[model samples]
Target: MLKKVRVQIVTDRFEAKGSLYETPAGKLLPTPLQDMPAKEDIEHMEMTVEASYHDDGDRVCIRYKESELSGMEGSVTSVSFRKSEPALISMLRDGSVKTALVFEPAARHLCVYQTQIMPFEVCIYTRSVKNCIEENGTLEMDYTVELRGAQAEHTAFSMRVLPVFDKPISK
Candidate 1:
């Protein structure tokens, strides 16, 4: 069944060669900056938007739009996953900027990124993918991008698909 939903997406990104800080356990620490993607070695974004959610058999899908608040005003995004492949997910964005990205653990996908200037081919290497939508209403992915054959950035992306429950009106 398909129903209206509210989707919250949070993305944390870092340059492949960025960061001079690490945790005591030796893990890279996400940089903190006032503005997003501010060339300060790290970027972060969180957005909530209305969407449609559907689940049938073993497949789950969520579709949403990109508003001006997201800087992708006319774009639409669709994300889907299958229960059998819980470690993989597919995302497609159409409109101003169009692209289809497949996220699978330890795999690389070559995709075309369409822009107003021109279309460029980019390479995406997935480090990890966890789809817990059906179980917990969340999906997470980590991946790196290569632009023009050069490593660019790494992004940790997560989203929650929550049902919108309306309150009853008193007559």
Candidate 2:
């Protein structure tokens, strides 16, 4: 069965304990990454995305207009997400956020990494631990993205999801 879900993502700044630099060396920091003060003005972004979603229990797919702002609104982008560890989904899936992006057309192992905020286009890759909270039949997911290299930007976002269901379509 296919299900409909309402997704709302709101993000502005990334409150980080320290800054991360993505270099040829790898993910690193100037000083000890832990026990540090949170940084400010890391990035500027205020976006609201509303789209149609389909989840087949095992896989989650979403399609929406190409631009949230002014545009022809004729093109749609489809994205799919698969569990990293398929076998232990129920046991270790909660509060775990991994890299997510469109699975086809212009596909890659990770999102097209960018250095600055394009205002209209917010593209950030996140592969980190997620914190989750449950409400009256709703779930909230929170995660962060970091600026890497000299021209990079970052953000921390919270996504609230509410599921909608309909009668199964008869074959």
- Residue 136 CA error for candidate 2 (Å)? 9.1
Q: What TM-scores do the predictions have?
A: 0.79, 0.45
lDDT of each residue in 101-141, candidate 2, tens digit only: 32121111223332233212222334332423122322222
Question: What tens-digit string does per-residue lDDT give for candidate 1 at 120-159?
Answer: 8876677778788888889998876766745467788999
lDDT of each: 0.75, 0.36
Cα lDDT for residue 22, candidate 2: 33
- Candidate 2, pairs of clashing residues: none
- Best candidate per TM-score, number? 1
Question: Candidate 1 — worst ten consecutive residues by lDDT sum?
Answer: 18-27
